[model samples]
Target chain A: MSLIQEVSSFLTHEADLLDQGNFEAWLELYEDDALYWVPSSPEQTDMKGQVSIMLEDVPLLKLRVRRLSHPRAYAVTPKPATIHLIGNINASEEDSLVMVSSKLIMTQVRDNVATSLSGAVTHHLKRSEGGFGIKLKRVDLIEAGGTFSAISVPL
Target chain B: MLTIDEINNIAGVDGMQARAYTDPDIFELEMDQIFRRAWIFIGHDSQVPNSGDFIRTRMGVDEILLVRQPDSSLRVLSNNCTHRGTRLCAVAQGNTKSFVCPYHAWGFALDGVLKAVPDIESYPGSFDIKDKALHLISAARVESYRGFIFASKATAGPNLYDFLGRMTEAIDNLLDRSPDGEIVMEGGHFSVRYHGNWKLHHENANDTVHPGYVHESSVTSARQAEGGVTPQDELVDRGQTKGMMASNGLTAKDWNAIELNGLPQGHSFMGGFYKSGLLAPQQSDAAIETYREALEASHGKEKAAKILGMDRFNNLVWPNLNVNAQFHQIRVVYPVAVNETIIKGYCFRLKGAPDEIFYRAVRFLGTLVSPASMIFSDDLEIFGRVQAGLETGSLDRLDSRRGIKTDQKNGNALQSTTSSELPLRTQSKAWRHWMSPDT
Candidate 1:
């Protein structure tokens, strides 16, 4: 496959791992220093300057994954069953670096109530020999004006 | 006797009547009597810190502009325009020179004075835009204590202090948590909707008895996660999961052992669980020293200790605001529907404290009360179910039956056990007083 096609497949596969609740496998899709961000405000670009809805380094992400999978995570007793639909994969070469943008729909179910959140996700990718691993993932929700319930998962 | 008084009376002991929740009549009355008369929290002074900066906030759905004028005083003015009553500000917050109404092109200065009208020649030179009739209506009373601003519509009543009464100490303790002797609304705000009576959440603020029960799953999980000999550990050890967290890890008999102090002006403070100090350890020392010095500077040292470490205080300032002193935060309830309430949670920056102290407040909200928290979600779920069930038209009354008679009456206020319904009763008393005609 071409470099763009290979990176696109890797991105789609990574999303599939998340939807399947295979968090450990999905964590492999990240570089050791990958950052996942869901910013608090639309204007927020840097985590140091402003708070984020979800700002996770690998260690913090590991802690969250540990909590979510624990049966005693009372908030997730039944678990938030979710399906991720990732589309519009665009890959562009910038100084030979692959940049990706896609639309995402994350449908979450908890205690018989279902909520579907639609957002645009941008992933910054660096091509490696095997494929591309995400350096950063930024998710911006369509419903930015409305209140967000506690955001525990990485969108 | 008018039906409004009778409705208010029935709501006295039962908390809020079903009619008040879904009834259009009671809501209209509340709009006039309770909202207009009482000192309602508009927004913090920090929200609009400079001249021309404004925040469009609500006082029971009546949108008002909380603006900072050129004179460095914050003014609460009706968001409505002077000409055609159009909303003056559309954005939530921004710095503006003057608000020009979109409909009529009439302009008003930041202080809400009518500056100009379109087509000045059309008025035959007889009209004066500077007249008092053309100025936007300012809130009847606007006052600030320690940077928190409250506005009321009534021209005559008790001053804000008289209304706040005993709860002022709770506000004092909150401000004193900062090493610099001040606090401001920082890290912004998080607002959520509760599909239940606003009073439900207000009453929940000091309902020390519910945490061990409604939030049992949270308390237990938190304790189990702590990996210690927790109250949850002991309860699970005794094979008593049902009442474990609800009992606050105490035995059923011990539940009756705690005190609930109801203060004057219909204010109440919960006095259980004195073991946990909400401030993080690092911030606590600096805060204490600074606060003691401040108290010595203001009052004295003995009074300062009495202020800072004086048990856990969760107090309600009359109608709409609840100051959780122990937590260094505030919950302001905006009644959207009689059955629906919007609650905004805010954390204050303790001016000269360590970042860990700020994190502790953030951690408190995240772990205990965030929507992602089962501890808080459990209580919210119960509140939702209660609101939905109340719609079935089955019962005329809700019960505040626990700790009713044993209450120590002090005329206009009362105290009971930790498990007592005194917070609800105290709020109801204030509600009745505020909803009454004389108010």
Candidate 2:
């Protein structure tokens, strides 16, 4: 497969692992220095100075993963089953920076109430030796500032 | 004259009358009599430390624009446009020269004086913008106490400090915990909407007895993750031994031995956590020191230790604010409906504490109250269940029969114990007063 196709396949496979409740597989997709950030602001240009809804180092991320899968976790009793559809993947390059954008629809259900959250996600992926590591993943929800229920896991 | 019978019949202590939460008529009455007449917290003066910085906030249902003036003073103005009554500012916060209305292009200064209107010769040339009629409607009274700002819409009533009563000491305690003698609002706010009433969450703060029960599963899970020890038992031993010392664990009897301190103005706290068998030694030490120094500075050493030992309870500040100074956080409740409520979690900087101290507080929020928090998830379930049950329109009353007649009254505040109904009963007193015809 071509480089673009390989990257696309990797992204799709990762989403599937999340859907299948294979959290360990999902964690393997990121580099050791990787950061998972969900910016609170739609126009947030930088995470270094601003706060994100989810800002995790590797250790914090692992703890969150454990909490989600823990049997005693009451929040996930009616687990939020989700299906992420990624489309319109656009890849570009500027000064060796590879940027990708995709239209995403993440349908999640909790307590039998389904919510389809559609957004444009931009991923700044840096090519590593064997795979691509995310420098940044920005999800611009059509509605980011309104009141929301809990969002515990990766979108 | 409203008899206690009428108050009880109109609304039970535990569950409220449907009209109190659902009916727009009652809301209007509350807006006119309670919100407008009472001194309500706007924003801390520290929020906008520099001139021209501003944040848009609300009181009850009224929209307001809180701005820092050129002289570094703060002003609260109605966010509505003076012209066609359009909302002057739509964004959450930002700094600007002067707000210009998009509709008719009317301009207003930051202090809210009418600066200009585009058409000079449209109406009478004698139209003077300097008149107070052209300015944004200012709050009836604006005042500050220890950098915390408040405003009331009605012209008549007590000044800010007088309204705060003994709660002023509570705010002082928060500030005193800070090394620099003052605290500022820090960290981003997490706004949450609950399926239940706002008062339920406010009342939950003073509930010392419910934490171990409602949060048992989360506590158990958290304890399990930490290996063969529990956090609560560790917390208690730390207080007696001082500094990271882990000793014998607490029994259910230990929880029963915890004391509850109920303060004036419907505020109360449960005090036995210091001796509880939960917190690690150092965690308990630092927390106790922060409380002790603040209390001692205001009152001597013995009085301070007494106050510090008395510290750990939830504070329900009159109408809407539920504060937990131990956690350096406050939860502000906005009632959306008789059945729905919106809660905003705000964390504070304890002035002079280390970054780690603040981080521990944030971790406490992370472990216990955040949306992803295990404890809050269980809380939300109970709130949701309460909402579901209340929708049945049944005549079932909320039970507050734990320690009713035995509670001591100190002015308007009620004092009770772990097994007491004082905190819940105190809240109902404030609720009744506000819901009355002549509060």
Candidate 3:
């Protein structure tokens, strides 16, 4: 496959793993120093002194995955099944590092109620022994300043 | 409609009726008696540090405009316009000299004085500009304790100090931790709406028992990851779960060491955990050292250690605010309906402290209290479940009787075990008093 195609495929596969709840495999897709951030505000930049929806290092991310998998995790017991439709894929590469951006529409359903979370997801990818690993993943939701219910599942 | 007797029927010592959480009529009455009369937290002084700086917030159902006047004083004005009752300010926060109503261009100065009306000539002779000045419906009483501002709608009541009672010490403990004795509101806010009664959020603030069970998954996962040998099935076992106290990095012994204080006026705090090194894990060694040095420099080593070593956790200020001192954030709860509530979390920056110290507080808020928190998600789930369950009418009374027999009254404060239900009982007592016809 072409370079762009290779990157798109990898992105598609990552979404698939998340949607399928194969969290263990998804956790392995990140570099040790990777940052997974979902900004609470539209133009939030600083993670240290500002609050974000999700700002997880590898350890925190692993804990999140483990919690989701716990049988008694009432928040996930009747799990909110999710489907992530990723499109508008764009990629650029320089010095073995690739920058990819995509539009995401994630539909999460639980107890017959469905919530559609649409956002722009940007990924900073680094070439690893196995294709690529995520250096940083930032998801900026369209409803940045709006009130939200429990965002139990990762977006 | 709930009758006076029905409202009076709420007993803090016993359990409360389900309608208290499900009845819309009671909710409206609460908006009047409880929210309007109580000294609700409006905004911090740091939010509007300079003249013309203003922030908009809500006092119960009424919109409030907290503006910094040119005189360097703060005024909490009704955001409603004098003419046609249109809302004067539309934006959440900004620095502006004046606010103009969008409907008909009626303008008011920063201190809520009438500035202009475009077509004054078009009005009848009865239109007197002096009387037409923006109806400055100021909060009956506005007071601040260590920069935290609270406003009341009632024209008469106990002052903020009397209302705060023993809970004032918790606020003092929070401010004293700062070397300069001040905290600046920083970091953006995180707002989450839950399908639950506002009381649930208030009660949960000082709740010690629910965390272990609700946050079992996250706590168990963290423990297992740290090489602890809790069996997967054992961790999931409902009977064995220890709630929040045992969750994350906190052990059962650490939970036991915590003391719960049920203060008067519906306020309460959880203490005795600050010395256990729970907060230490959230801070880097360098940041802690720097913050400690600063604290010592200001208050000397001994007193600074006492302030820094405070064990207070969630401190509820009666009706609306939850001050989490250790985390350096205040959560304001707004009830939209019987089953809908919005919680806004604001993290503060300790003035004169290093940037890393403030960042550590922000990190704690982001990881533990934000909507994305695995720990908080569990509580949210329980809140939704409780709301849904209340609708069934299967459970008429929710229990708050735990540790009641062991509770000891010292002056106005109630002291009990770490896991006591005294906080909920204390809150209900205040709820009964506030919702009464003759408050």
Candidate 4:
């Protein structure tokens, strides 16, 4: 596969793992210093100065995954089954990192209620001997400014 | 519509009727009597620092424009245009000298003065431009306590200070934590709309018991990750522990030490968590030392220690506002319908404090209450379920009778144990008083 095709397939596989509730495998795609961020506002730039919907480091991300996997996770007791449709995948290599951008439409169902969220996803991936690992993953939702209900799972 | 007798029947000293959370008519009555007449927090002074800077917010159902005047004072005007009744400002917040109506091209200044009108001669005689200024319906009373602004629609009532009563101490304690004795709304905001009555948000603010049960999953995970065996671990054996845990670090003794104070004017707060003179763990040792030095410089070390040692949580200021001194964040609850509520959370920065201090506050704001937080998601889930359950009519009365027998009357304030239902009971009493026409 071409480099672009390889990047697209990596993201597609990542989405598959998330949708299948395989959090352990999905988390393996991240490097030790990975940062997962979802900006709260469209103009949000400073993660430290401004509050984001999520700005989790590796430790925080692991805690989130642990909670989600727990059986007593009341927020997701029934578990939100999600399907991620990724399109418009584009990639560019800059130095040792590969920048990839894609649009995502995620539909989640829990307790007979379905919620559709559309957003832009950007990933900064580092090439490893085994495969690629995510250094930074940013998800910017279209409805970031509006009043969103509980965002239980990662986008 | 509900009669006076019916309204009285909905809430009492013991509990409240389920219909209070499901009936549309009762919500309308509450909008008029409680939300409209009472002093409601609109926004912070820092939101509009420059002249002509304005923000659009709501007071109950009515949209309002909070504008900063040339003199740096704020003017709360109706968002509707005087001419043709078009919505004046559509943007959430911006810096604009004048707002022009889209339909008629009529313009009004930041102070609600009618400035310009397109084609002035088009009108017949007797259309005085000066008299036609934006029909500014001023809030009956507008006042600021520290930097927090509150406005009431009723022309006759207690002043904001009188209304706040003992609640002012909570606000004072929050502001005093700042070295310079002031705070600014720094981080933007996180808004979440829940399928629950607005009252549920207020009630949950002082709820000390729900954290253990509702946040069981997070607590269990945090404990298991720290190599501590949680009670739930026996249910599901997930081996392999030892990692950085994400727990509140609150022990059973700490939980038992928490005291719930029922203040007058329907306000209450939970205390006894941060008696060691720190709000949460400081981000870094450098930040902690810098903040402490600043505090010591402004106020004497002894006084600053006392200010920092004030352990308060979830100061519910009746009807709508919830202030957290620990994190320096304010949450306002807005009722959209009987079964729908919107909550807006704002995190503030202590003026003259270190950058890490503000960052720590923002982190707390995001990880504790924001929609993305697992902790808050659990509460929202329960709130949504409660609203749905109330609609089913299975339970006629919602209980608020815990710790009532142990409550001690101290002046205007009623003190109770940590896990008491006194806060909810006090809130219901105040709700009943405000909802009554005679009051």
C-alpha RMSD by candidate, in order:
6.4, 6.2, 4.8, 4.8
lDDT of 1 by residue, A17-104 (tens): 8877888778777766677666555656544323345555554455455555655444456667888888887777788567888889
TM-score of 2: 0.79
Docking category for candidate 3? medium
Clashes of 1: 3
Q: Give the TM-score of candidate 4.
A: 0.92
**How many angstroms is residue A75 displaced in model 2 relative to the true structure, after the best TM-score fit?**
3.5
CA displacement after TM-score superposition, residue A66 of candidate 3 (Å): 1.0
- After superposing candidate 4 on the true structure, give the runs of residues whose Cα lies further than 4 Å from its correct spot: B1-4, B113-134, B226-253, B275-284
Off by over 4 Å in 2: A21-36, A39-52, A56-74, A88-104, A116-146, B1-8, B13-15, B71-73, B120-134, B226-258, B284-310, B337-339, B350-352, B361-370, B410-412, B419-421
Q: Write the per-residue lDDT of candidate 4 for residues B209-272, one digit (tens) a residue.
A: 7777787788777665433343322211222121112334455556657888887789998887
Off by over 4 Å in 3: B1-4, B132-136, B226-256, B274-284
Interface RMSD of 1: 9.6
Which of the numbered candidates is closest to the native, going by highest lDDT? 4
* Residue lDDT tens for model 4, A37-76: 8988885688778888887666566778999988877889
Angstrom error at residue B181, model 1: 1.5
- Candidate 3 lDDT, tens digit per residue, B144-185? 887888988899999998889877887898888889998888
10 residues in a row with least lDDT, candidate 2 chain A: A46-55
Model 1: DockQ score? 0.17
Ranking by TM-score: 3, 4, 1, 2
Candidate 1 segments whose C-alpha is farther than 4 A from its true place: A1-37, A43-51, A55-83, A90-101, A107-116, A122-138, A142-146, A149-154, B1-5, B12-15, B123-133, B224-258, B276-308, B365-374, B410-412
